[model samples]
Target: MSEYRAGKAGINAEAQARINSKYNDEIAQETLEWIQKITGSPANTAGDAENLYEVLKDGTLLCHLVNKFQEGSVKKINQSTMAFKCMENINAFLEAVKKLGVPSQETFQTIDLWEKQNLYSVVVCLQSLGRKAGNFGLPSMGPKESERNVREFSEDQLKAGQNVISLQYGSNKGQQSGISFGNRRQI
Candidate 1:
């Protein structure tokens, strides 16, 4: 009877391990799908897998959910208002971090590296989870599109506004004549 009981327990343990593996696999698949959807990038690097695992392991899932909710709420608020609130959250987190007296440089360096790798969404999500776990004062700054130098504008040669100006194209001017503007309307 003892031998039979031992066998049963071993079997149960093995089954449990399999279940855990399957669950992990499902989570990974879901996370990959999410990343692909968000980034519109087809290829997945090993770094992406590791990063996703770290995020889920470190209680960042909660933060992602919180961000989703925040985005939904922002849908109701005007873009400008929502942007202001996001900026406020970022600044508030920064101030709170300083008040907590942690090494600001180290914390910022970690955040900066993650941002440079385009992992700001994950950082934001993880920070949200950290806040809920009584680890408040984490700065949750998402990546700004401006981090990349690429810019977009209407292809039409003619744009008119009080703040708008015209660019005269000459063969003498190469890419330098890219029609630079200042204090121009964002519209």
Candidate 2:
């Protein structure tokens, strides 16, 4: 008899449902459209997470997508059907996107895309890349990238701020509540 797989079906199903719930068809569709527009390649999905995975699993189009932002970002695009080759392509695309200013936190792992474990994370990474694309004057799909607002305070202003007791410091104003915890209710 085969050894019993502990917590296999139940745990896997719950985790799968949780990951599925995080996926947004609309966002996937928008990401697909944006990728198609940028790479000039037609995707074969209807914007669903599964379709999106199929469209990006090979990582070829992703490499092309990053190249659009920075020429030759991914110097070589693999054309092999082997698993490692496909993962290499994904890694190349990820590294290229990182060079293009996509935050490390925003990018998903190779297995996340390869195994289809977390397609939502893939979509989120694409959305983050789309937002970062705006920084390069490209037509972005998601929200525009926020511009850095660096404020330099003068010495006098800094000194003035030090003298002020901000509300965040919790000034009680010498007041105390008459309530107590862990006591029986008083009727």
Candidate 3:
């Protein structure tokens, strides 16, 4: 007798299609071109999600790309085809990019690329890295990252802000609902 097994819980088809719809072929193509220019080699794949995944799933190119931004950022790039080895390379690339000023939130998890679960997220991470590349004096692919804008206030300004009540605390003007709470209805 065969034992019964349950299907894995994961994203539904509609949700997956929604995510896939958000993936822009143009952006992916540009990102691939940028990677090729930086790495000095062709990616040898079309910019679609499936092709991009096949090209980058191993993570070798990602490690190479990060190293171009910062010399020796990823100390060891795995060359094996083993699952864990590829994941290690992806993780290493993520860590190296994080050190190079790419925010952790902007980076993709290994499984996202490894399993092809969310290729759009991978493209987003690459685009973020490309934007961060501007800090290294390299040509950026997408929109440039915004610089930090910090403001300081004097002691008087701080005190004035504390004393003033902002209009955001909207005035109720004693308005009340006609209905009463915790009261029984008379038949």
The candidate that wins on TM-score is 3
Q: Per-residue CA lDDT of candidate 3, range 43-103, in tens? A: 4646887778877988999999998898999989999999899999999998988898888
The parts of candidate 2 lying over 4 Å away from their true place are 1-8, 168-187
Candidate 3 steric clashes: 0
All-Cα superposition RMSD per candidate: 21.8, 4.5, 4.6
Q: Whole-model lDDT for model 3 versus the true structure?
A: 0.83
Find the 10 residues in a row with the least total lDDT in model 1: 72-81
Q: Over the stretch 45-117, how does candidate 1's per-residue lDDT look in tens digits?
A: 2344344534333222322333343333222212232434434434433444444433454233223222222
TM-score ranking, best first: 3, 2, 1
Give the winner by lDDT: 2
User: Would you estimate the TM-scores of all the predictions?
Assistant: 0.23, 0.82, 0.84
Please identify which of the two predictions, 2 or 3, would achieve the higher TM-score against the true structure.
3
How well is each residue in 115-157 modelled by candidate 2, as lDDT tens digits? 7778888998999999887778788877777878999999999
The alpha-carbon deviation from the true structure for residue 136 of candidate 2, after best TM-score superposition, in angstroms, is 3.4
lDDT (Cα, 0-100) at 40 in candidate 3: 69
